[model samples]
Target: MDIFTLTIIVSIVIYIFIGNYAGRSVKQIDDYFVAGRQAPTLLIVGTLVASVMSSTVFLAESAFTYDGQMGPFVLFPQMGTVGYIYGALFFGRYLRRSRTTTVAAFFGERFNSHRVQQAAGLSIIVALGGYLLVVTQGAAILLSDLTALTYTQSLLIAWLSYTAFTLYSGSKGVLLTDTLMFLLFMVATLLFTFYLVSDLGGISAAIQGLSQLEHKADIASWHGVIGAGTEFPTAMDYLIWAIIIDISWGIVFAVSPWQSSRHLMAKNEHVVLRASIYACIAAGVLQVLIYGIGGFINLANPDITPSESAIIWAAKNMVPEFLGALLLAGIMAAALSSASTFLSLVGFSASNDIVRPSSPKKTLNLRATRWIMLAIGLLVLGASLFLPPSIFWLTYFVGTVFASSWGPVAFMCIWSKTITASGAFWGMISGFFLNVIPTALQYLELIDLPSYMDPILIGAACSLVVTVLVSRCGHVSRQEKVYRMRLHRTPAGERDLKQTKISVIAPAILALYGCVMAYLMVTFYVTPYQTASGQLLPNGQVDWATGEAFLSVSWALLYIPLALLTYILIWRSYSPGAKNIEQAQTKA
Candidate 1:
């Protein structure tokens, strides 16, 4: 084996070993389900980051950045950073405080209805299923290209191996291994990236050359800077309406059932909050590095297509066999980490949501749960075999489904106290059709727009407003109504919270991102990059100036001080709700 392949194998083995060791106490449901609620902040951060920054970021974004107006565009990073902020401020701590095993439990408790549990359960199942499809599709694509393996063989091999792996250790191993895999993947990729960039001219030389090229190839504007381009390829905003309209879809996950699955694994609220902050910082860095590196590769090559192939092309050409293998392994690691967690969460939801049927005799049927998980594995395995080859397109369809259905309901549940079960049901159902069905039709080319953000924006808005209107106009529960009244009476919490749905730090970071964005925007407008011979290169050949390196440094400066304060707050919170933090906090 090459050194990189050997490194990857050794890394996977070590992670499995770590997982086995950590899971020595897996004797019951609690142990298997939530790591016995003993997860520390670092593990929480690692696992959550691993889950979020999957192959989608590495391969799909790498490929798509080419045709995109700006490499990866600014929206991807902005949404990711802001999404984590929402999770931290709006969802994470509350769910931790709510003391629920599953986010579904939170919905069930808050809505005083079994259907809400069903809602949480169903949403997670779909998300996980979509996640599995993404994992298998990526594995097939990567292995088929990288190794001698055929696509089918690679997909099957991956599916079977992961199935065997997860069956043995269940979620306990998932937790431990995800943590280890994330660390390994990050280290390997970052080191490989450092070498790759250094091998290209130093950072400054690379940037100066790229800036010159940017002058020749402005795809968004033909003759002038702001001149509009054509349909499909020219339209930069794929999900413009969704970004503005359905911000909640992205925001809800930090605490909703899909996201809360990762959070509830923590030992306490302190861990949850710290992990949230960690997500924000990690997301910021990931955005700049992945996007900037793609731009850098294009800077060297000049003419690339589709943009998504940036990582794949970089692996073959720029990187040597050994380092390339490690990058590939890191890709594998991202897929595995996300898929396993997705499967575990889905399996839990199936048993809890569909089959088990909430009852007084609820022992959580450990054996039944295992069987349900196996059944889910089989279904995913089948999909992996028969499904389309590209996860890039397919997973988004799944994401659209989840984002539309659960997205609206979950957002209101966390941020708005007035949402009722009836309202949630009607609104979410409407959002689902508006978001997913139309998007799917568009993807199939039965329609015009790729993914008009308008439906989601409209749906989410209507859902919340309608949910509130229905709740208020109809027979509202006295106790729930009273609680909301009391909460509103405490205007200190409301006023302190209203403008900043995210944390205090979010506004600052956004302002910073804004300033950076303005500078880049100005550069794009005023200056055109040039070749040494004064030849204007094609669009792919040009690049935005290196804003990423600066963003990374800026993000660090902002994160450190805020993190220290977060730590102090957590110390105080955890001291009162000591040892059995998850349960203790729940009870209190």
Candidate 2:
């Protein structure tokens, strides 16, 4: 017990050290909001990994993987790649294209409308809050699982620690601690995966065991079982949803605030691409490893919670004491890294999204923002304790909200120049509520929506139809569209975006990684797809030779080189005096 407390204390101390390391970075609002727009690509990648991957990838993904295959949650990892790529290839440029602090603020400036700003702000709040709650809940669960700490005690510690870190250094603090947390978690999870997989006797016997227990007296397949209560998504359905919603949410969610926040915080347009491209790959790797551990654990211990802590369990029951302590440290790292990210979002959203201060005293405004962040942390802790949600479900729920609201809004705003502010607002409002209404209905036992299988699909469609019809009928014209497209003077630093460093490498790397994943589709099913068969895990080990040949360890190795190539290609690919993303991002 003392050793376990020592592990947590050590983790907390590391976070504090990182926070202090990031000091001397918060001199202005730009620094607070965008991390001075001068963060190195590596640091940007760290923050992105820490933030976007967050609690869901750490705990929720493990939870789901423990009981089932990654199922539709595989989309969670795949979308990590997709979201970052979209942000780098298109959304990042557009965000910098518009001269505003928050994405919502940009809408108001570009369209000359406050309603659009408000709508966007509301969406940002929901997305940010939901994400924060998800991470906070995971942290609470961690405390409960590992020690005698009550859910509330764990939540308070998680929230307060994260809030205090942000209050001190803003994004600088977030970036520094996030990097440490990332490194710690990755190494720890790798160790855990290695031990867990090895324990099952070189993977083959593991598979044999899994096959023997496949049915477990439950429904044999999806055809036999139906609904969330039965066992979440069945096999075929999980695979199909994994591809469809996973793909859509990947691109759509990325374009909005989640990845955009990182892009905005990046040192330069180049950093945006570099970070996203690498962050995507790292996130994917993290998922594969955690799920692999999940698979191996359940293969050995048949009855595990959806929130799988098999690594910890295995360490206690199977491994030596010192190694078990190390494994626990890694789990804490995963949880802490995620907590820092949520802290950053909650702070940034409260400061910029919900309440954008126009006060002249920059220092005073920053202090106020810090206070708001602390408040938000408390709120998140409360939410986590009171409204504990299943990790995968919470993640999907938040993704659905983001897709329905910001996804379509960003698409129309960036690509369709004729999109009116009111039109965009209404589109988002309708789409956003499409999700909320259904949720409320279900809660009240009002409607019989088949399942949570496609909440975002319906919401996104509604947003599109309403906005298009309204835009055409009420205000926009063909001429206005053309006129808006005409290149206005770009922002101060962004003379030409295509010529920027991101244009060359990020896209190709992302495209290639996707191709390889699709072509071979790795044979080792660490995380079994959730099905009606009582969430049967893949008990058997897969022979690497029998698996798809495309899944190389170097899944997205070229992204780094591609990013370097992007730097050089900038000279050839684009023109000057066109778009000044730097100047735009540098300003408030």
Candidate 3:
């Protein structure tokens, strides 16, 4: 086998071995489902970032940048990163306090209702099953490219590789292997980014060069390359579309099963908080660089077919052989990490919440979970084969499903004293169907909705309305009231004043970094554009009016406010003098 195929094969073998090694320690249901609830910040952060940075990031998103939609693409993930902070403050710590193995179980216990738990579980399987299918197709495509095999043959190989380990080790294996894979891909990404930037004559030259290219005019602008036949026909159109979908993605990061479940694996609420801070930084930086790489790949070869394979193609042709193989392996690592997480959660929920809820047999529960995972694996494999691959759109569609269905309910279930179990259940169902039905119909070409009436926006609004209206009809139970109050109680052991102070420092530093980034943009991007007032456009003449209009409303100005707001919010919630900390310490 050539280096590409050989590298992927060896990587698969290593992943399987690591999964087996981690599996040896799984003795009970907790060990299998939540890593015995003892994962540290690094491991939790690894899993949190790795689990979400799958083929969706490496392939689907990269394609958007490659196709010159970098402006909207970048905005979405930056907003999503803030969800880590939101989740840490409002949702994650409460989930940990509930001491539940699954996110659905947390809902079940919080509401003191088994039906709500099953509803939540059913949503997980449906949403994440579709997500798993997309991730699988991503890996299959990568495998097919490297080995020159048919899509079906590559699909089986990719499926079996992730399934073998996920089936054997469960959460424990997924967490450990996810961390290892995270380290591998992160290193590879940094190296590849550095080489690509250098090859394109550095960032300054690349930006300048991209600006002068006629066919890709306005590519480096905030709206991307908007015009006839483009994704966004005007700057306002791009802005409206990006903001709605971007906020939905932010909700996904905050409340989605795959993302928030990592908090359930954390050793403590502190670990959850710290991991979110770290994950926010890591994910933001990694995605920004990946989008840049995607755009940079276009500078090298603009004719990449399917567009999703731009990164894979660039790896083979743009870099050295060893580095090329490493980039391919990194992409595969990203895909596998997310696949294992999604598949493991699906199996965990299916057995723990659906097939037989409240099983007293811990050993039996563990055994049955593995079998269910295998069954889910086969089902996803079969479905992936039939689904025509629209990698980016499929991922975007499935991912945002949670933003509407689970987002409102997830937070309200934690903070709203008036939200009843009946409300929560119906809210999830309403948000789910309302979002899915319209989006699917639009996908089928039956109807067309304007950008403002996007399915996610409408569905999220429906969920919130239904939840509040339905909540008024029911009474909050004593158990539910007590559970909600209990979630707010700060445990004595978490009261490390020094650590809390240190944690507060991170947000402050992030705020400072945001200012610095904004300054860098003004210096490198804005100043250059301003100086190019006389630079010829595609028509071989300057359009000073349009350029001046863009400069008046630069995206850079939004950074400082967003960053400072994040810091203020984090400080109020996380400072040592915060109500929870002060109240608990005084009692102590």
Candidate 4:
């Protein structure tokens, strides 16, 4: 066998070994679900980063960037940085403090309703199922190109490798193995990116080449880039839509099951807070490096078609034999890390949230979780093999489902006391259907809508409005009102005004930072000036001079400060006093 294929085989073996080793720790449901709630900050950070940066980002987003549908550096890194920071301060810490094992369980406790928990769990399954299909299909396509296997055969290999560890080892195995995979992928990505840049002569040469290309204007235009010239439709084509999608999707993604569960696994709220900083930094640096490589590769070899194959093609054609093997292994690592996490999540939701809640048997629950993991793996594998769709569309569909259906309810549960159980439940259900039904119709060519009217935006608006309206119309009982008031209380005690101020001020500062960055992006990157004839120009379609200015200013002024500020805010929020407060709460 070739060195690349052999390396991939060895990596798969190592992952299975690690999963087996980790499985020894799983004697109980707690260990399986949340790693016994004893994971340190670094493991939590690693797992969170690995789980959140899935094949979608490495394969699909890189493909989109290679095709010039969006600037990965401009969009993804900023979104993640802002999202995780806000999540750590507002959602992560508080959610961990609530001591819930799952996001669905948190909804149950927050609203005192089991039905709401079931609804939340079902929504998670649907959304995560869609995400898993995308990851699997993306991996299968890449593997098919690399090996002589058919897509179905490639998918079976990928699915079995992903499921073997998850079914045996549970959360402990998943997290530990995910950390190892994170390291492997990080190294491979750095090496591949370095080689790509060097092979293109340099960053300056790459950019210049890209600028001189025939599609230079199209590539640089943020609001008008197409996919493979025609095969994929333009989804993000306006400045306002891009801004909203990035920030909104970022926040929802941070609180999603695979990401937020890391907070629960942490040793303490302080770990959750600190690990958020670590995850943000790692994600920001890696995204910029890898996506920069994608852009440079496109510039070097503009003839690489199908766009999604750009990264794989660069690894094979541009790197040395051994390094190329490692790069391919890294891609495998990315795919498995994410797939394993989602598999485990679906299992946990199935057993703990959906099944065990009604049946209430510990041993049966444990066995059932394992079985469910296998079932989910097979189910998603079947979907990928039989009903495969384009990577971008699948991701967009699932992302919208999660963002619109679960996003509003999750935010309100953590931050607001007035959202009634009825409102949360109905709002989620309504938002889900409203988003899915129209998109399904659109997919079937039975209806058409304005290009700019994204389903996610509409669904989120409708969900938010319904939630507020229903909440206002309903009344909480005296006892439940008091319970909610307690739920909102700071662990440091409400008497501690200093802690309260810190809580409020941290998010406020981050919000200010996000707003400033948005303003800068709009002013420097998205705005369009009129021509000499007084005709208006299209946004994000700038002249060469304007493009140079935008790139230079954004590189120096925007991302650097945003990164630094994120670190500072996280450091400040995880004070010794915060730990003391948490300890005191534990004692109480």
The clash numbers for all candidates, in the given order, read 14, 22, 0, 0
Give TM per candidate.
Answer: 0.79, 0.80, 0.92, 0.84
- By TM-score, who's the top model here? 3
Q: Put the candidates in lDDT order, highest first.
A: 3, 4, 2, 1
Top lDDT: which candidate number?
A: 3
Q: RMSDs, each prediction?
A: 7.1, 6.4, 3.6, 6.0
TM-score, structure 4 vs. true: 0.84
lDDT tens per residue, model 4, 1-588: 878788888999999999989999899877888899899877987898788677777777777667664343553335645567667666777778777778788777778788888988998788888888888777777678888888889888988888888899899999898898889988888887778778877654555455445753455443336555543265444454556567666766567777887888887666776677667667766776766676667666866778778888887788898898898888888888988888888877877677534343434457777888788888888778789557776677776676778778777865666789889988898888888888788778798765556677778778889998998989655654555555545554223434334434443444444456455444533332212212224553434354323443453355456545654544444443544432343235
Looking at candidate 4, the ten consecutive residues that score lowest on lDDT are 527-536
Residue 411, model 4: Cα distance from true site in angstroms: 1.6
What root-mean-square deviation over C-alphas does model 2 reach? 6.4
lDDT for model 4 comes to: 0.71
lDDT of 3 by residue, 82-183 (tens): 788778777887788778889998888889888888988999999899999999999998898788799999999999989999999988899988998889
Q: After the best TM-score superposition of candidate 4, give how far the Cα of residue 67 lies from its true spot, in angstroms.
A: 1.7
**Candidate 2 vs 4: which has more lDDT:** 4
Question: Mind giving the per-residue lDDT tens digits that candidate 1 earns over 1-588?
Answer: 555446555665665666666556678777777777778877887787777667787878555444433322432335545455456544666555555667776667667667767766776777668777887678667666666778888777666545555655666788777777777667767876687768876654554455455643542231112224533442335335324423543554454454567766777554566567666666555655665566667665756664555776787688787777777788778877777777778887787665545665766856777788899988988887776756666655565455556655665665565678777766666665666666666778787653344445545566656666776766546664543333222122222222223333434454455455445533432233333323343753433333333332333344445444453443333343224232333333
Candidate 4 RMSD to the correct structure? 6.0
- Looking at model 3, the pairs that clash are none
- Which portions of model 2 miss their true places by more than 4 Å? 70-80, 215-236, 318-323, 354-364, 443-446, 451-453, 476-588
